[model samples]
Each structure stands twice: as structure tokens, then as C-alpha cells.
Target: MENELLGKFKLVVGMEIHFHLKTEKKMFCSCCADIWEKEPNTVVCPVCLGLPGALPVPNIDAVKKTQMMGLALDCSLNMKSRFDRKHYFYPDLPKGYQISQYKQPLCIDGKLKLESGTVVDIERVHLEEDVAKSFHEEGKTLVDFNKSGIPLVEIVTRPCFRNIPDTVEYCKQIQLMVKYLGIGEADMEKGQMRLEVNISLRTSEQERKDELPKYKVEVKNINSFKFVEKAIQSEIIRQRELLENGITPMQENRGFKEGSMKTVPQRSKEEAKDYRYFPEPDIPPMEFTPEYIKDLKTNLPPTPYMIIDKLEKEIGLSRNNAKTMVEKLGPSYISKFEKLLRMGADPIQTSNLLLNKKEYRNVSEEEIIEVIKNTKTAYSKMEENELNAVIKKVLANNLKAVEDFKKGKESSVMYLVGEAMRMTSGKNKPDPIQLKQKILDMLDSDAN
Candidate 1:
């Protein structure tokens, strides 16, 4: 009965991600793009403020970066493309419409394949200018145009995501790609990269026939991946109940409330006609030759997928382990990992230390090599039964910590391991890495 109910409906999701390009100036003007930690309206100019007689001049560097990004995502670069004005009104948008690309975007038909082997199709990757920052206070609103004209790129994906894990992995891979290519920081907390999800639920028959639900709920401007996951799950339940009650869910825009982890109604969603998109008259159409496109492609750097392959084949690391290293440590630390290997550090131990111990990343290569040697020596001298006895004692003493570890609080296991280390002193000390793994093993056995 449970399996029958579970297979009754499928979740369909598509994502629109807006990321700021790390350019020196704004998209359409000569204003500073580094608006972080700047005063309100300090970086504004006539072009960004949308004042009378103000005209926009396209930033050549931003255009190049967008093309570079398109190449990185395996997108087809359009030989000739132009900007368009998208009509929208808000306190933050000083201009009646935003300068964005519509009918003809810079790149199209790109795809990103997740580690799980799910390929997400990219519908379009367009260029645009960011709006100003808005702050609402007591019965009043304030606007800062410092971020108004920063270079922004929007990546629109087809509605192909069936699960949250695949969706989140796709987002992480995009972040990794941007970092590797020096495009943007993609720091969600600082609003460098923002995520918007369009989700709906389909019946089993509809899914089998490759059909889409009529109504989709758009969760906009989500900052964290955790919130994205929660919002999707919550919206699924909300829509499912509506269907069960013989009512179709309304198509609308919603916001994710972090406090309660729920999606609340915002407004009716807009269609293409509502935006009233048109080509920008101020800037001329962009043209790229075959040679130019080829040059950009040839100068492109290696992607995360290439690095993951190297880790697996050359370094002999497992696929999952290599992925974790690249995803967490990022592109900056790839050289450090390679250098440590040249310094005679064991591959498995070096990988473990870098992944588990945050402090180990800051030390010199010589210091890291020495620590690995010392840890091995200490681990070999320790008796297996003695280490097990200490770990068991730690677990028995800290019942709450053990319970927390079982509940998926991985940090709790570290707390238990620390207690075991405290119990044994000096020459009898067990390797912290081995101690953590043994503790986890013991806990898993107890659960079974």
C-alpha cells in the first residue's frame, strides 16, 4: 500500500539561477561593480540611476565573461545577439524596465550532467543588469543603487528535475564551474548567486506519458540550498493535499520562510506577455565571428568534471571521495593536493586529512607530510583492543552524544572521538582519523 501511494505522483522541478559576473564595472555603465561593503548609492551613475537623458553603454568585459560562461556550460554561442528591455516595476528597479536579453539570448541549448548521471538541459543563458538593493523599515522603504548596474547572468533550465538531490547537485556543479572559470564568487549568503525553483506534481500516468502539470508554483529568491530543499518538499506536500481534495493548485509566486520552513503565498505569477520584452534601442546588436568564438573556447580552463576524472584515474581515489574533495575544497586547493603527493604523502591519508581537518589546509606541505608520518606511527603502535575499549567507554559514558550521532549529527561523532582521545594520553594516543571511523562503525553496528 505504501509503495502504491508513493508511486502515485512524481515531482517536476526546473531552476532559474541568477549569478553576478565578477567584472570591474557594471553591465551598461562605467560604475564600479564591487558594491560589497559600500555605502548606499555611492556607486550610482546616471546610467544606473535611470535619470533623464541617461544612455547605457554596454560593458565589453561583461559580455566576454558571459560568453566565457556559456562556453564553460557547453552552450552554443550565437553569432549575433542583442539586448532587450524587460518591463517590470518595483521600488528597487528605478527604471520602468530592466535591460535584459529575451528573444535572442547569448547562449542556448547547454547542459549540465550531475554526478548521479542525470543530465539537466539548459534552455538559455542570458545577460542582464542587477537592480538596486531595497530595505524596508518602519512604514518606509530605502533604496541603494550600489548594486544597481552590476553584471548579471541568468541561466534557465528545462523542467527536467524529478528529485531534490539531482537539483541541488546541479546547483553545486554550477558554483564549482564559476569558481574554476573565475566568473563569480557564487556565495549565496552575500547574494552573489540566487536560486529560483518552478515546481509541480504530476500523476504517474502523466509522468509515463512525458507530460507536465498545468500549474507550477515558483519559489523565488532562495539564498541557501537547505532552504531550496525544504521549500520543494513543503510545496510538494501542499500541492499533493490540494490534489487529494479534488482542487488544482493555483499558479503563483511564493516565498520560503526560513523560520517555519514553509512556502507562503506572494502573488500571481507573470507570463511572457506580462513582461513585454523588446530589443534595447540604445545598444547595438552584438556580433561574434567564428574565429572569436573559437578563441574563447580554446582559452577555456578545465572544468570540475575533468578534475574529478584526474583524481579517480591518476590519484587512485574513489569516485565519491574525489568528488567530495573537489566540491568542498574547491578549485583553489587542487594544487595543494597535488603538491602534497609530490612531497611523498600517502594519497588516502592526505585526502582524509584535508577533507576532515580544516586546520590541516593552512599548514605548509612539509608540516603536513610530517604529521601524516607521525599519525601512522602512533596508529601502528596502538593495540586494536585497547583502542576499541576506549571508544566503547566513551560511547557508554556519553549516552546523549551517542544518540545524537545516530540521529545523523555527524559532528556528534567527533565529540565522542575527542572524549576517547582525552581518555588515552601521549604514547597510547590513537589516530584521530582512525578513531572517528571506528566510532562510526561501532555506532552503525549498535543501530543494526
Candidate 2:
């Protein structure tokens, strides 16, 4: 279904990702960064609240995190970076203008390679202070400055994506990269990682250039990857219908209506001149030495791609299976699995129990090793006759599945084998291959 949709229009996707840095204090104030389920307004201070006579100070940890992210993405780190004021009018903007980087951002020119081997170029990565949260109820809106001055690193990517699935995978790759860097948790549920998707459609054929493509539509504040894909898909369909009806697509900001799976226009696209960006006088230009960048590089964690390669090459697992396992188990959890594999368990069985089943939970390396060892020991101890007897009892108990197997229902064999294993308390005393053969032989005898 997705490929059929992609066949109609060329999807161009660019992402603006806002990642909250893990710092102990607000960007320009002494307020605690840890928001730990406190009262709504308790974490605010004079600077964060934008009171009179308040001053702003840059957080060093936030700056370093921005630089580290730049390096991780293979971006050119700017030795000198400065802040600017982005003018906007909203209740969430307590200071009236957001202190952001405009002319000189911390990093520029980075690239990320997706699992599909497609490379996406990053336009730039800049450091900025976050805005406060807004709560609206009963037609009245309230602002909380608790999150106003938190440090944020915005990563802007080039508009090079081809499809909705590619866009979703790109977002996931960026989140994994940020988490591995230990700069932020990158949890979408916590608003730690926020996404703004820019989508435009072009002709599927590369050579047709008689007319330009539709104007890009921006979808703002998409918190989930699933919603990102849905928004793009809907937008592409909407634009296609507009063009087919002899109506041109408009350049505007749209909000993804989650419940309805449609997009509603918020406003027309705003240019940089509309923001009225200007350098801030209060803070001076910040600079970093080469030694600082080198030190940060040394401390960087292994990225998802690197881990995927190691899993496939060193552990002898298929690429698709490794990627699936790594995503669900996390890097640390996969490390524990690797340790168990080294202790002599069947690789395929371990992968199945961990990735292919839903019944397993909180599995430990020690427990896995013990289970494999016990199963091997039990199989060695039992004679062929004893194992055959166990299989016969299980077949007699599960007559329905046995009859289904005799009728050439292949799936029923698994249920019968599982019943046999269960009846013996997982000590059926044969390897899985051998156990299957014994069951087939018993079924053949029953037919005779």
C-alpha cells in the first residue's frame, strides 16, 4: 500500500529535530534542570521567567553537548559560535524573543547513513534555549516558565528523503544517535525529542522539469514518528488531489490532526526575515579549542550502525534480525545477550527466545546460560526409548493436534512438540531437531 502511494509522487522530507541537552541547570540561570514530577511552577527562577533586571548566562555543558553531537554526525565544528534573538509573539515566549543561533551555529555539514544505505545530509546543528510550555483550557491559556530556559540543540537536515518509511527511519536513526551520545534521553513521550517535518512532492520521473514542484508544507511539533509518516502520507495525497483539480498547492504551516489523520493549515510559510534575527549583545562569542573537540570524540559512545555491524560480523547473526533485536533490547540489553552467546548457547535458539517470542521478559544472561546447560544435560541423560515414551504420552494427550498433523496441517506439529516439551517440564531429553523427528515417526506409526 505504501509503495503504491509512493509511485504517484516523489516525497521530499526534511527534519528539524530539537533535542534537550542533559544539563544540571537551565541554559541561562541557576534553576535546576531536573523536573522530577514537581509542582508546575516550582522550577522557575528570575532569568527563566524573563523578569526585569534578569541576565542570561550560557551553560558550558550544553555547549559541549552541541559540539559532541556535531562531531558524531561528521559535521564541521565551528570554533566560534554566537547567539541571536529570534523575534516571535506567543504566550510561550516569555522573553518575547528566543535566544537562538543564526549567523554562526555550533556545527555544520554533517551526514547520517540509514540502514538502507541511504545517506542524509545535515544542513546545520545549532544551540538554543528552549521555550516554556503552554497549557490551554476553557479558551484560556497558561504558561509555565519551568522549561523556558532549558538548553536545546536543533539539527536541521537537507530535504533529500524519498518516502514516508524513509522519513520514519531517519527520525529513529537520529534518536538512536542522540541517545547513544548520552547527551539526552531523546524520549518523544517526555518532549525531549521534538520533530518538525517539511514535505514537498515532485514528479516520480527524474527528467521531467517542465513545471516546478509544489511548495513545501511544514508540519510543526510532531512528537511521534508514526504521526510523522501519517502526516507526510496525508499531505502527499492532499497535494496530488489539489494538482489534479487544477489548483496549486500552497506553502504554509499545517498541524497534524491526530484523531482525524488530516492536516489543517496554521499559517503561511514564514521567511527568516520575518523572524527579525539579530545578534544578542548580552552574551559574547563562544569558542572551543581543538583539544576540546578531540577529548569529546574520545568519550563518544558506539552508534547504532556500529553496533549492528558488530552483531552481524562477530556474533554471526543476519542483518535484519540483528537490527530488530538491537532496537527492542537496546544496546546494553544486547550486550548481555552477546555475553550469553559466548557462554555456549545455540545462536538461533537464543535469538528466537529473545526476538521472536513475546512471553519472555527481564531475561538475564545467567538464566539463559543455565537453561541451555540444563537442557543439554537432560537430553544426554535420557535414553532413546524414554524420549520415545514421552512423545507418545504427549500425542495421546493432544489427540486433536495429532489428528491435525496426520491431516497434513504443518502448523499443528509445533503445538504438539510444544505440548511434549511442556509435559516433560522442558526436559523432553532431545535436541529440537531430534524431538521433531521422533514426533513425526510416532505420527507415522499411528497412521499404520
Candidate 3:
């Protein structure tokens, strides 16, 4: 089936994502990269400012973090990679050029598999220096050099995406990966992660008579994932309308307007010739030996998918719970919860405590495991008198909850179970599931 709005064409989209690396300083300068929390222009240095005499020294940690990122993406580590001068002139670029990779990138040939079984091929992951942010204030624009020269990584994907949801999912997956890697925050609100969507309309599979589109229109620097999705969908519709009217869409760079939910052209697309890319004389080529890449791999954490798989397989966590754990919690938190699960904690209860509440932050792992142990021990069928006595006391203490439960709010029984657990002293504690069933039987008997 084809989209009726698109007529004879199908959508093809690729994304270029930029993430600010979590390095301590600028990519090629000693200036602190922690300027996000600082006032403007205070975090600049001569090297970051691109003064005539100043030279750039590469950040080895940034390179290593990039390779670690590559390993997490299942990308092949480029043993030999180098940086080049991407010459361009903009108010934000003090150097009138950017130090980025062109021919040889740091990582190559990776694949990101979505949960829906769609695998998008990664073209390359390259290292680069960030440009200063431009702020348009009242009657004038301001440039903040504090963010200039921050270490950044650019991931380019092949044009394999055909729908909006898959594209959004891929973006989300990458955000989770970088956060888990601890390489970058990938925070969209902070301008840490940016998305560039390249999309074009091509003839549908059944409509082979129509000519395919040759030019790609890129919507760049989308700050939010929702906007990125909307921009792609809007571009598809816009391009299809052009083709239907017998006009070819122009190749241009565009920006997403949130108020209108439309993509407006920023500038006509420029070729590599416009930038005149060449080798950067200030920085030398980066070459990593087998031992270095191997060492980098050791520091890399497991991918989010792997962590999700482990949680689901080992603990019998629901798919949704596993996804939440992998996306919301970092590698350390996931590892901690996995250890507790291995210690025989109930997955359902532990997962509930892990998320949807912040109180677990104050609870220790030992304390959580102790509760699980007590619950398991307490559910071994106490003497009938003791069980009935605990239930009676719990029901008495939670009369409102009892009434609510009898009045068809079944969820109130869990509150009564908490009371029953509180009534049991010592190492014995009630499992909410088992206690709820016992209370149900007791209430039914009273009714009869």
C-alpha cells in the first residue's frame, strides 16, 4: 500500500546527527567545555577563538570516546583517520573554517536495528569541532564563543528510512546509546544533540513509469524529536505535490517552523566545492593501533538493546519495563538492578520500585533484596489462625480500602496488602500478590 497523499511517490529519508562529546575541554583548545553552565564569552581561549598565531592540539580523550561510541554502535573502528579543514564563513565560526573529517572518518559501516526489525545502515561517525551559538536578540544578534570548539561527533546514516515513526525511533535509539555510553548527554534541550533530516520522494514500487527524484532537501538542526518527525512528513507531502504538478523540487537546506509545523528554506544547497575542504595543518592525522582500539573496546559498555535483552531474558521483565529500564537508567543502574534480580528479587515488584517513583533512590540494594526475601518466606502458608489474624488486623486497619475493594475498586486490595505486610513483624513480610488472593477468599467467605 502507498500513501494517498504522496500519490505515486514513496519517501526516502536519512539523518545526520551531531552530539556534543562529554570532554572536559574544547576539541583543540584548553578552554573548558563546561560553558553550558557558565556565562557567555567567559570560557573562550585564543586557540578556541582561532587567533592568527594560536595552534590547535587534538583531544585524545575525545577520539577515544568516539571509538568507544563506534564500538557501541557496532561500527568498524578506522585504524587510520584524520581531520580536515571544512572551510566556511559564518559569524559563529571565528576561524572561518571548521576542523572536521571528510575522507577518513573515525567509525564506519555500522547498523542500528530497531525493535520493529528495521536495520538502518550507518555510513560514518566522524569527529568535529562545534561552532559558537548565535542568538538573535532584540534589534541585534549575539554570538557566544563559549560553546565554540567543543568536541562533537557526527553520525551519518544511509537513506534507508521510508516512514516517520522508524526515523523517530532511530533518533531515540541513538540518544539512548550515547547516554548509556557516557560519551555525551545527547540532550536536545541543551543543544547537545541535533538532527538533520535528508528526505526526497521517489516513485512508488507499483508506479514505475514516473521518474524518481534526484535532488535531496535537507531539514537541518531540528532541536526536538517531534519537530524532526513532523518536518520529514511535511517535506514528503511538499515534494510529492511538486512532482504531481510536473515540477522538480529544488535542492535546498531548510528549517522547521514549530508554529506552522512546516519546513521553510534556509538556503540553497551547497556542494563540497563551496566549502573547499582540505587538510588541517594545525592538527595531525589520527592513527590508532590494534592495541589502542582493543583497549577502547574494553571500556565501552553494552548497547541498550543488549541490556534490554538481558533484563527481559534473565528477569522475565515485560518488554515495556525492559525498554524503560534501558532508556531511563544508565549502565550502572541497569547493572545494579540485574544483580538484585539475580539475588532472587521479584522482577515485577523490583521493576515497579525501580521506576515510576523516586523514593527508591534512598533505598539500598540490600534493603530491597531483604524485602524480596521476606516476601518469599512469608508466603509459604502460615498456620491458618495466624494468617486469618494478620488479614483481620490488616482489614481492620484499612477499613476505607476494604470498603473501596468491596465497592469494586479492586486496586484497593493492594493497599490492604501493604497493611498486612506492615502487620507481620520480624523477617516475615507479605507478598502483595499472595496476600491479595488470601484477602479475596476471606471477603468471599464473609459474603456467603
TM-score of each: 0.85, 0.80, 0.82
lDDT of 3 at 65: 87
| Model 2 residue 49 lDDT score | 87
Any idea how many clashes model 1 has?
Answer: 0
Tens-place lDDT per residue, model 2, 1-448, is: 5556655666677889998988999898999997756678899988888887788999988998888889889899888999999998889886789999999999999998886678888999999989989999999998877888989999999887876767888889888878767788888888888999998777756416534365789999999988998898888788878766777689899999999988889988898999999998889998889888888888877787888788778876666556766777676667667777788777655765675444543666778766555644334444666777888888888889987876548688788777777656443445665466557656765765
**How high a TM-score does candidate 2 get?**
0.80
Residue-level lDDT of model 1, residues 241-316, one tens digit each, is: 8998889999999999999999999979999899999999999999999999899999988888988899989998
- The TM-score leader among the candidates is 1
Q: Residue 62 in model 1: shift from native, Å?
A: 1.8
For model 1, the local distance difference test gives 0.87
- TM-score-superior candidate, 2 or 3: 3
Clashing pairs in 3: none
Better of 2 and 3 by lDDT: 3
In the range 1-448, model 3's lDDT, one tens digit per residue, is 2376566678888999999999988899988888777888899988887788889999988998888878888899888899999988888997789999998999999998998789999999999999988999897889988989999999999887878778999999999999888888899999999999999988765236544458899998899988987898788789888888899899999999999999998989999888899888877887778988888788678889988897778767656567767877677777778777778777766766666445664578998776656544333446546777989887777788878876558688778777787777765655455556567657655544
TM-score of 1: 0.85
RMSD of each: 4.4, 8.1, 8.7
